[model samples]
Target chain A: MKIALLASTTLDMLPSLADALARAHGLSLEWYVASFGQYEREVLDPASGARQFAPDVVLLSIDADTAARDAKSFRALASQALVSFPTATIFVHNLVLTAPDVLSLLEWNEPESNARMVAQLNLELSGVALGSDRLRVLDLDRVVRSLGIQAVCSPRFSYLGKIPFNKLGLQAIAGQLVTAINAYRGARRKVLVLDLDGTLWGGVLGEDGIEGLRLSNDGEGKAFYDFQQLLLKLWRSGILLTICSKNDEWLGLEAIRTLRFMVLHDEHFAAHRINWEPKATNIAELAEELQLGLDSFVFLDDSAEERALVRAALPEVLTPDLPKDPSEYPTFLMGLNCFETLKLSTEDRGRGALYVQERRRRYEAMGAVSLEEHLESLQTRVRIRAAHPSEFGRVAQLTQRTNQFNTTGIRRTVDELRSLADVDGWQVLVCEASDRFGDYGLVGSALVAQSADGPIVEGFLLSCRVLGRGVEEAFVAATESLVHPGRGVLLRFVSTNRNAVALKKLVELGFVLDEKTGLFGRVAPMELPKWIELETVSL
Target chain B: MPHDNIFPRIQACIVDSLKIEPGRVTQETRQEDLEEWDSIGHLTIVLSVEAEFDASFQMEDIPGMTSVAILTQHVEASGSV
Candidate 1:
């Protein structure tokens, strides 16, 4: 990753800390740190080194004093950064007051104290980057609040090198910077597979009945109650919740639903396996049923033995140690940066509700006379169209999340898709599907382009929620009409371990693979099922 | 606290911070002896020593305390360690 650092203060000591943090997360950062007082020439001039470097990310850090004195100029420079680094994801540091004491004395909207100026300027910077996917706040204020204000600044270092952060402060800022970088790379865990016994409440549910579990609105139970509150926030933010416990299914579900102080219920979890089976086995079953990879799971259990078993059985799953005390659970869970996601669409906010709708679909499936009859009865429709700038977020999200039914496992950020939209013969296709149950909003995307050999299907993927209803066949057939049709339409497949089902669908659609060339070719568009009504537009 | 035994402990901290070998440093080692312990690394060494010994040095005393022998004396003077 290329990171260009621009700061009003000297950043001589920051790169070593930042580089070490990046390396720990398997990222090698190529950094360009500009000299002092050259922000104008470095960003605006065409021939400057920063402009030529064309970074993947830009970090702008300005101290509280400099920002307070020239708030207007810094805000203008931040706005220009969007135009300057057209494709780069820009990060602007929010100013922080150096001293913690006297913070309560400052009045709102008053610029007399440096604390008030810093707070007002930070709010304005947020206003500038509102609703923008490329521009983001690095949030230095949050870091300073966590570490005490005095811990972040050193007068000796500031005098010697104009650097604002001390050693501890540099470590904290570097850790947060890497979190933003990992978020940009789409390296986020999707599912929180939690264990129940002593984790959710104080006592084991089997040993102590649901009435005896220490979960209430106050006292020792307040610790567990507060822990559930944070987990509820994660559920609302689109993290899939699941249960893997060693208890009776009926009893566990009773405690989760009937308790007065319980913040989560059966509807919040996408799925669960509350049986006496080993947790690792149950987690693998959940992964298979959800059609998600094991790498996207985070397992939390109070028992050290359960955590150790999951870690040994599935090395891909992230199992962090749980503190012996449950009161520290909320703080520990909040400190984890694995749940970071950049953009949340409508589909994200209603994800848990969508799973509830899926249960209804499953019940409807069981009542049908046959598999073919059930699919046709659902009334599935597939719509493929030219992707607009607004739908790019959903399209990029599908590329990052889909694993099993993908033709080519390619990941593209929203910024990458924006740059690709300008090419003459390239098509970014948004595939939205729906049935009688509910709407699956923008579930798939395909990358098709008019190459010298003709239109080639470069990338294709769909959400597992919309899998079994001839959607993949409909998507491939629709791509044929997208490019010039006279030449033979071609598709490429690179086999991944999870994508064997994709190859079966391709062969079923009459695409024959040439052994010598390793390319799948079809002279005409394949036939779609009568149940699939494809809506397409020619480029 | 006995001040005589703290020199080797301070030397270990400096070697660990600079990622250097321990054999090259004695009680008399200074900043000029190693290429990695330049001006910027001087700050790293000072921070490591402060953290290791639980002492705080004022700005004026940092530049003059360039050797393990001098740093041990400063660590004694800060008196918190």
Candidate 2:
């Protein structure tokens, strides 16, 4: 990530903050910190450091004093940022009042206090950014309040070099800024694998029985109930929930089925592995069933032993500590930044329904004698066509979230996807899958461009729910038929930590890897598997 | 606190906070002698020493306290650690 730091005050604390943020997000940050008082000249000039830096993200930090002095100029900076770099996303920090007591005393009997004026200035700045897609307002006031205003600022540093924030304060700002960047770029975690017993409810299901379990009604049960309600809200907003519990399957089922006060039932969870096996094992199996990366999971268990074991075995899974008291669990879980996203697409809203459909398909596969017979029974149909204007948001979302089966793992925003769709030769094909179980809405997408050599595939990905049913081969064959005859298909396979399944599938389908470019390609007469009945149509 | 024992602990805090070499941050090291020990670095070292010793200093005393020997003396003079 390339970031250009533009601040009215000294930028002495950003490097340390950037180091911590970079390490946490598994990203490298190449930063360019411009000299103080250069925000205007650097942004306005055509050949200034802002343009020459060409950063992916630009962070503008200005103090409350400057904002109060000229509110119009403060809000104008966001527009200037957008006009300067049309593609780059700019993060402007909202003003934090350094000396509220003095401001309150000086602005007495006025319509609004100086602090209120600064608040209004921040609101107006946010209003400006709200009208533009490439600009965002970062709440420095929230950062100040959360980290404590006194601890975040140092009088000595401010007096010495006009540095506004201390080390911890700068770190808090960097943390929030990186989260905003992740939300913008679509690198958010997807699944929440919650534990049972002390995690979900107040007591053990086997010991307490269905009627005896404390859930959501009285005293201590209200906390558990509230947490369940929170999880349901996440579920409704498109977060997949699963269970990994060490208990009798029937007992767990009885608790979920008979607990009338529980907000979530057996049907709410996408999958559950309830047995005596280690939670680490069950979590891995749940990831396989859901076809999500371990990095995308957050494991919540009340047992310190269980949390430690999972942390040791699967370091990628985020295991947040739970206080011994059940009352604090809800607030603790709400504070986690594990599951954060800027926008929710249609596919996200329908994700729980799609998982339910997959469960039915799994049951159907269990009874079938052979793999071919199982697929034949499902009556699967994959519709390959150009991405429509209505599905642009979902297409962009799929590019961001579909990591396990993504070939290149290249994420695109809605505007970028729309521009690509408008191009003459670029065809963004969205795959809609349906079967006997149900309709899995917008399960796959591929971006292909007509090159001189042939049609070069920029990206190809399928949802895990639609995989294992010959959808991969069917989608590929449909894509091959879309291209002009006698022209070969060039496939690009960019390896990531979690896309091995995609790479393996491509290699199995006779796509040979080019040693030089590290991309996969196959020529004409690419064979399509007989089991798949594929169809292609123009949008 | 004994004045003799404060030198190594202050040196450790300086080395750790500034990310400087361990043995090189001796009692003789001054703010002007090192490149990273600029205005901000000086503040960081002072704040870090305050935090490490659980002490506080006035804003006026910070600019004068630059060297390891002088900073250690200032921290001891705060008398709270």
Candidate 3:
């Protein structure tokens, strides 16, 4: 990934140091550092090297004095960068206040004080981040605040090379930025499988019963309470929770249901396997049930032996070594660098309820007489239209993330998607779906192009949440109505390891394989499933 | 291996920061004697020495203290370190 590092000061060593820092954490990023104090020029001039680099991520590390004196310019620069590079996520820095700013205690509280100005600047910077999904604040003030500004700054070096901080301080800044970058790149762990005994609470359920277990707002149980609080936050942030415990089913379920301080109840978990079985087996079963790959799992167990068993059995699953003291659990979990996500969309925040709905939907499937009737019972409504400019962010995210249901398997950045839509004869169809259960927001995308032969489905994909509800067929129908592929609609698809799910029902969808061109084409128009109600959202 | 002797540690800091040969730095060795010891390298050496000895150098003491002996003398005089 290309990363452009533009700073207000002479940070000649930052690019190398930041790249080394990222490499240390298993991320490979190519750095393009602009010349000293050329941040504005680089952003304003379209032909500048940084602009020509066409980076995926940009880190603008502005100096404190510049930030305090004039934040509006920086905000303007950020906006300019947004227009300059549509694909990139711009992370602008918050000014790191040194001792000089707060040295005069009498003037510290003054309205025009440097401290007040920078604080206001940071708030404005945060607003800049909130302005768009692609923009974020690098938040260097957090590091400087934690480690006092006196320790981080070097006046000698500042005078010499226009660089402010020492090597240690620079590394800390780099670490924070890289974490934000990783989160933006969607490298967050997807699931957290936890042990119920001595992990979620202080005591084993079978041994001590629900009354004896420690979990409360205060006292010795506070540790467990705090741990649960963090776990619940992660669940809300879109990490699926599950229990992989070696305990009887009823005992665990009963304790979770009736416990006053149970932050995560049975409804909170997407899946649970509470039988007295090997935890690795239980976790694998939960992964299968959730339809998530094994690699996205992070298993937590209080017992070192259980952690070792899961670690050895399933090397793909991340099993962090447990600290014996339960008091250290919350802080230890806080120290782990696994749970970081950049964008929290409506779909993401409600993902826990969505997956829980999946379990209920499966139960509904079992209750229904047939698959067709089950589909009818779903009552899914799909809104499809030309992809709006505002939705390109989610569309790009879907293209990168949606693998199982994606045909062609080609990932496009927002810049490429915009260019595609701008071309003379192309259409970018976006679909949002809802059912009797809930809304599967912005679940599908299809990129179509007019070729010499006919309309081509350049790339098509649907979110797996809407998979069984006939949303894909409805999305295709909406696309066909727009394209009017007379000879037939042809799709450009090449098989990948994870994309076989996209190709399975192509023939049933009226597409025949042209083995010679390796394309799927249908001479007849696609029929939208009767169960799915399609509406064209005139954009 | 030795305790209460900050001289060798100060020499090591200079060598490490400047990337000089081990024997190139002596008690009397000055910045002019080493090819790698430029003005920027001098500040880098001070920064490393600051980290090594857990001491912050006075800005006035940096420019004149070019020799290894002067650097070591400052470290020894900063009794808390």
Clashing pairs in 3: none
Ranking by DockQ: 2, 1, 3
**Model 3, TM vs. native:** 0.86
Best by TM-score: 1
lDDT of 3 by residue, A1-539 (tens): 89898988766556655677688768898878888778889899989999999998988888878866676786577778888887788888877777474448855667778777777777877886787877887768888877778778888778866768886777677778778877776666788998988899998788788898989999988888888888899889878898888888988889899987888987788889999888888888987788777888999999999889999999999999979888888777756767876677666788788888888888889999988999999888999988878787678778777778888777776657777888555788889888898776888888888888678888898877777567767777677666773345778887877788788866567778888977788767667778888897654
Top candidate when judged by DockQ against the true structure: 2
The DockQ score of candidate 2 comes to 0.42
lDDT tens string, model 1, A252-298?
A: 89888887798888778888999989999999998887778999999
Better of 1 and 3 by DockQ: 1
lDDT of each: 0.82, 0.80, 0.80
| TM-scores of the candidates, chain A only | 0.95, 0.85, 0.91
Clashes of 3: 0
Where does the lowest 10-residue lDDT sum fall in candidate 3 chain A? A480-489
